[model samples]
Target: MLDWVASLPLWQATIFLFVVVFFRAQLTFWLGKFMRKGLIKSKFGKSGQNAEEKRAGIAALEKYGWPVIPLSFLTVGFQSVVQLGAGFLDWNWLKYTLAALPGYLAWGFIYAFGGLALFRSITNGSIGLLIIALIVAFLVWAVGAVIVKKLRTNG
Candidate 1:
């Protein structure tokens, strides 16, 4: 399957990546919905203590969630959370799909081409370079994270 994808043109690769991400995101959304339904059926949801608060929270999420989908796509480690949050909120399928389109395309193009090159690089005996690059990237990320934390704490 991956070999077939690798042989395709760039545009086709992008489409394939888009489909993959779309499927994954949709599946995540569905899982969120499933969990949400379970929660509603659970004892906590049955309790009326926080009914007003729950309603308000859902209202806020639905109202302010439009930007989150696209922004999450541009970040690391936050995409699944936002996608699941949408599903848990029972976001309209159409709305979620539309909001997520840009993210889909961005992720698609990035991974489609980058993944191919990355695979090729590894297969062509660039393992040493790949390892070095990975270490450097990790260091940069770690240093940047520390700097940001210190700035936040000291600012």
Candidate 2:
């Protein structure tokens, strides 16, 4: 399914992944912004403990978010939180964009180059461990899915 990405030249692949990361981050940020705006428009965010918590959360995020944004890219789930939280906190555009750009570019280069290298190594000489790891991963996912499905049905 993802073979075409490997076929692309390094520069093209880098650009492609860069755009992918850019759009994904933008979308995640906007989604949070939209939710925040909707909450503001409605009565839900007007006055409450939730509102106070939200305010405090926003303050803390603003104070620390710039530093965390770059580190977020190295993670999986935490990346989304940092990106979305930036928007939820109504972070300034320049600050957030500047903070996030390095991570985005780093991801682009790492994935574009590291992924190609992995595919090459797997195809060329190091298939044994890679295949075993992939098989184990698939088995784990399949087993976990079946268990979850059964639990859902029983519950």
Q: Which candidate is the best by TM-score?
A: 1
lDDT of 1 by residue, 19-133 (tens): 9989999999888888888888899877863676566656666666577787667544468877998898888989998999999998888777775566456657677667756
lDDT of each: 0.76, 0.72
Predicted candidate 2 versus true structure: per-residue lDDT over 1-155, tens digit per residue: 66688689978888898899989998888888888787777776655536554556556556544777887776545678778877877787688888889989877877787754664566575665567567656755764476455444443
Compared with the true structure, model 1 gives a TM-score of 0.68
> Which stretches of model 1 miss by more than 4 angstroms?
1-7, 48-50, 115-155
Q: Against the hidden true structure, what lDDT does model 1 obtain?
A: 0.76
Best by lDDT: 1
